[model samples]
Target: MSHFNDFNNPQVAALPGHLKQFIVDQHYEHYTPIDHAVWRYVMRQNYSYLKDVAYYPYIPGLTKAGLTIERIPDLQEMNNALAKIGWGAVTVDGFIPPAAFMEYQAYRVLVIAADIRQLKHIEYTPAPDIIHESAGHAPIIADKDYHEYLSYFGSIGAKAMFSAQDFELYEAIRALSILKEMPDADEEEIKKADELVTYRQENMGEPSEMALLSRLHWWTVEYGLIGTLDQPKIYGAGLLSSIGESSSCMNPEVEKLWYTIDALKYSYDITKPQPQLFVTPTFQNLINVLEEFANTMSFRRGGAYGLTKAVESKNTCTAVYSSGLQVSGTITEFKVDKHDNPYFIKTTGPTILAVDNKLLKGHGKDHHKDGFSSPVGKLKNADLPLEDLSADQLKDLGIIVGVQAKLDFESGVTVNGTVKNILSSTEKIQLITFTNCTVTDKKGHILFDPSWGGYDMAVGEKIVSVFCGAADKEAFEEIVYKSKTETHHADYDWKTRELHKLYQQVRNCRLKQGDYGFLGNVWQKLQHDHHDDWLCALEILEMLEHEHIEPALTAEIRQFLGQKATDEPELKKLISDGFYLIAHPVEQNLVF
Candidate 1:
């Protein structure tokens, strides 16, 4: 296996340092035989039921996505197949931050969770897993329209401005998911974590752009439906991966509504099955709705509204000026003019002045370690906008180099200094640095004092946009990559290990055609020792029933499964479904 920041796939290789930090080794050897059994069970169930209802053809997509109905997919193999379709796969421990997840999609890559769902939570698991990420998401990537919408959504989601409350809610969800996945997690502990999640969700106080976008993502990407509302087909990764919900979500009582901008108004509870789902007629409509919602985000609508979101976020974000200058920092405050346009903005700590997402030389965080404050808006006496004025135009206005310049803005901000240097891009003035500069607003608030060293005034007619993260993320060094919380890995007890051995013996029998007598032996062991376990018995029964040999042993195993189903309510559907698939094969019914 390759080490850190190494992947054979080109798409995976192209990831930046920050994203690479989230990648973890798949450790394929760690998956026990029981784990493979769980994966096999879920895939078989999904394929049998989903072939007719899934938007993408189920069987063919399996091969196309580098998956199998037989076992947990090899991550490297999945990447090789995904690469053919302009996509690649990488494994992360569990749930990653949403922004980073979207950014991965923007790069045409899939973020698969390394862990597989436990057998106990076979039907449905709250946490993300290999089944959900690889099987549920990859197959659908074969559709051109759907994949296009997916990548576009990623691009938009990457730029969405999220708030501090959004991060709180995200952490809460992550914690709860980790707790729920642990085999020995306490009920009381789970309840407390769940309550905290619900509380944070309810108290987020008006969702930010990223919060609202997450709703759209949940409704569409995770739980979305397609085709007519009367008979919408399953396409979402959440629905396709969940054996329980994949069937239940199709019930008429679940309430399928048309997908639209109103999806932003709907929120989701990760702990429960969705009571309602949104249906789109086509993948193109998904993009249309996303575009509509994006127009309302701070990334598209700048000035006061956008900057206010940045301040509320209390995290690193970027603000774009009309002059094409990018200011990346944690904005602490902004002052607006009488017309509600942001005329000045301030950052609390290290900041970067960038253009076109590239860091400007000598204008990095170290140079502005104390923070940055810059005045915006048009000059009071300039003919053209300050940003558009050429060198000749600026000199004509007496704003020449090596001269003491006094510039006044219509918004009543004033700058007095000796012109030291000017930075422009394609005739647009991006920044103006000065020595012994003093900046003050109309109300005599000293925004910048001469004692603070050289002043770099950002030039723009208006603040054009605002978004989450630094414009040049590599330059900003996104150290907030690895999550503080980790998904729990359960240590199987001796009894569980013995059960795994039985499962492995069954798999070897099917793959090698080793022995029919061993099936009888395994069945007897299951009846005397691991009597409560049904999956192992089911696998043994499958081989016996397929060969039409060991009739007496087959009947005995069948009786045990029937009785177990009756005793365990949760296993009823699973047992019955397995029986139906065995009797009615999707294809030649190979020995898996």
Candidate 2:
């Protein structure tokens, strides 16, 4: 029998190497016959119901994505089908962090859970499974407009960081998802997980931006309706994937409301079918409402609200203090001290005295015997409303809002210039700069929106690089790192060396090929070593089939064939994973 713990650890260990942390392998062989049977059962049943009641795009999208009611779909293979439409699928181990999930979508990559629900949870699994992720979510990406909206939503959603309390809510839900999927979890563990979930629900105050966005996703992407209230069609992934939900959601008993931004008012329970749903008249309306709501978020609207959110989201940010020093970090907290002092916030990564309260000046020094202080008055820097300041006034304080900004592509320099027209889009900030243009050829033309390059920014804030000619996004990151109160060091060379060693090990495997011993050794690393090397092993195995080698080397390699070895299914399957990749390479595109 399949165990819940197995589901919790369903990620195919070797796939998502360092750069592609969002991906994993499906480990197709791990699925039991029962798993495939359940998939077929659900697909066959749901297809009939969906064809009649589902949204027009649902069926066509599914077909375009090459999904069929046969067996459980391989995410890599699905990516192949999705490739024609400029999208790709990647497998994940159950649920990942919400922000991470959004980031993947921003890159046009679909994150699908690798595990299939057990027979017992066929109707609905509180935990995400292959059926929910691949079947429910993947098909919709086939629609170009819908795909754009989904990714745009992800870009905005990624910006909504959580408060410490709200982050706890996120962690609690993550814990619950894992615990509920742990087959051997004792009664005590279950009790603890249940308490956390309950606590999060009971204590949650006015929904944070992250929470509200989640509610919107649940209503629309997960269980939404489209068309008129009287003649609604099933479009939500939750409804399309579930035979039970698909049929029940459209029944007269369920309350259907026209989808609006106000839908954020209602909270949802993932454990049961939603009692009410919001229906949209058209897909374009979804994008409009989403973009409008996103603008109201703290990241888009600079000031205390924007800074506070950036801190909670743990996004690296640059801020100027009254004393003129700038600092950036993976911000951990944004709160007033007990003294009701709101002059300074706290950071965890590289501790520095941010604001000196006694002197009332921002200090960039690493040492802080008397704790951090602010360079500017608390009210002036963060407490003041954003609307109170003009573009030039904010610019004087080193704050760049929507204005004609000078961008130095060569030096990565950006500064406030003159005010120009502002443009709007679902994914990013768009604006035209005039008068003081450095790019002579494109003067009076629109500067590129940084969001197109995945640069996280405040609502009205335009990026002005301090460095000259550093047009790439790396230049922007370098500016933040350089401005930090202390250097944040990472040992890149050492990490690269270790990865190179793993590649050498894969190369060394060719010498021990007797009875597939070389393959088994690769299997061991795939199971035990770090993920970065997993891809190297797969690539090595994929290449070994045709590479000519000494016959003597082959004979010597066979010596270990008679050695007894334990048969671990996962390891055994991993040894052969290369063949699958050869057939279906994960193809991803940069959708800026």
Candidate 3:
């Protein structure tokens, strides 16, 4: 409740004069002691588990980002570290829109949420927080390739568009997050917020272009893994940040599928633990699959295809069809025929246009709205009412008689009865034709006789549940997170922090004699596996060229430089200059 950044002020988000309104100050002082405690507990829990199991660069990236267990990180201080590695950090109140977030990523800025989850939600927070953003995402940004991959992915993702319905879901997410963050939010308010989320999800229907892009984002960035399925390691931010889900996701029972382009077909749920995780063999594989997936999207191509892609990408746009007709609006609904192919695009402007399976232009299906489920059981085959039908006439028209029918009552309750006849309304505004049915009370006495009459509500009869509809299948198989109580510690043998410090010293020309052996081992370890880390070791060798250096070590440096050096011109120059400095003791003015 402390007014950090004046969070309680209704106009705080509208503050002017900033480079971007979404970026906010960390407001470190606003976090109470309990908040700090939660940060520490979650950090310690996650770091201990991730130091060994997470992506190879995560621990080093954490240390290089200048983060510690001491307190929550100040974005400015974190930026100081990130700047060394060609990245930076920024803070936001909570979740930003998908496009805004991707745009930030494209610019190499981490969009961290300033708030921390309360103790009750320590294991997971549905909203973005310091733990999920800084602790979860920051550590891996230090790696050159992984960071570049993020930049490329973000650039492609920034072009995506979404339907108006998708925006509604996003707004619901923002609303729910704000409600959860409120210090005095009551249970009733929380339930209402949860229901809003559920309503949005239910209405989203099948995967649209934007939804598919989100699925890709979720699988790789949120809950992705790296390494072979038989021996997957945690790399995704979701696993890197969570205490419970991290350990749970790595269990053998969880389905660890090999990361492939087909991974795009899957959908995920944020409310539950993932039942399946896609594992890439390396960070480079993430880049490969992402590029492949991006190529398949229509938005990047621009056209009718691009139009769909634009809608998929979460942007509202004005586009001209081949007929030279232009339409501008947010896409609201989409539908496919029974074959599960896209057949129509509906906009909130109340416009519906038909597009073939390949997204080619087609005339609007005038009855497109009829495809949707309606209160009157989606009137089909005939526009006329089924009233004034005798028992024989009803049977002739394929109307099933003697079925239990449900009707909305005046008291907001639904009651069922056996159908006897059909009748039409005579009122000026005839609500709906009704079926005469026999209604019996609990005592088995018939309270009402069967008769045709005008009714105020639409009537529907319960039928056998059909589960094979195009959209009836579960979007994603439910995943369970089985929590563990055991505390974890960093596997000290890996020396993530030590390697980070050594690398920094090399960058700063501060390496000492005692560090040579460790540097030698690190160089050897990185030479075959990591081009970037190997280059850092070479830089350290270049810095070590001095008068006081031992002849044996100098010889070792020269030998490795000669045999393992690449044809890269900059590397060749660094090596040539390093040997020259070793030769001319007084001419040691060159920078490392």
Model 2 agreement with the true structure over 403-508: per-residue lDDT tens digits: 4544322122232344444322333222222334332211333332333221211122221111111112222222211111111112335554455455445544
By TM-score, is 1 or 2 better? Answer: 1
- Assess candidate 3 and give its lDDT: 0.55
RMSD of 1: 1.6
Which residue pairs in candidate 1 have backbone atoms (N, alpha carbon, C) closer than 3 angstroms, thus clashing?
none
Per residue, candidate 1 scores C-alpha lDDT tens digits across 299-346 of 999989999889989999999999999999999999887789888999
Per-model CA lDDT versus the true structure: 0.88, 0.54, 0.55
Give candidate 1 misplaced runs (Cα > 4 Å).
Answer: 589-592
- Give residue 80's lDDT in candidate 2 (0 to 100): 63
TM-score of 2: 0.56
| TM-score of model number 3 | 0.52
* lDDT tens readout by residue for model 3, 1-592: 2233423222222222221555666768766544554665566556555667887655466777767653578766687777778777767767676765675677777788888886567778787889898888888888788788887877666555556576678777777777776656788988997998888888886655567777877888888888788888887898888877888887877898988888877867677799899988888888888878776655434333554454553333433332212223344444333443332333442222211111112212232222211121122332333333344544554544456555432222333454544423331111122346443433444433456232222232111111100110011110111112111112323444455544544433432435543555555554555444323444545545643454565566567676544654444533453354335432112111
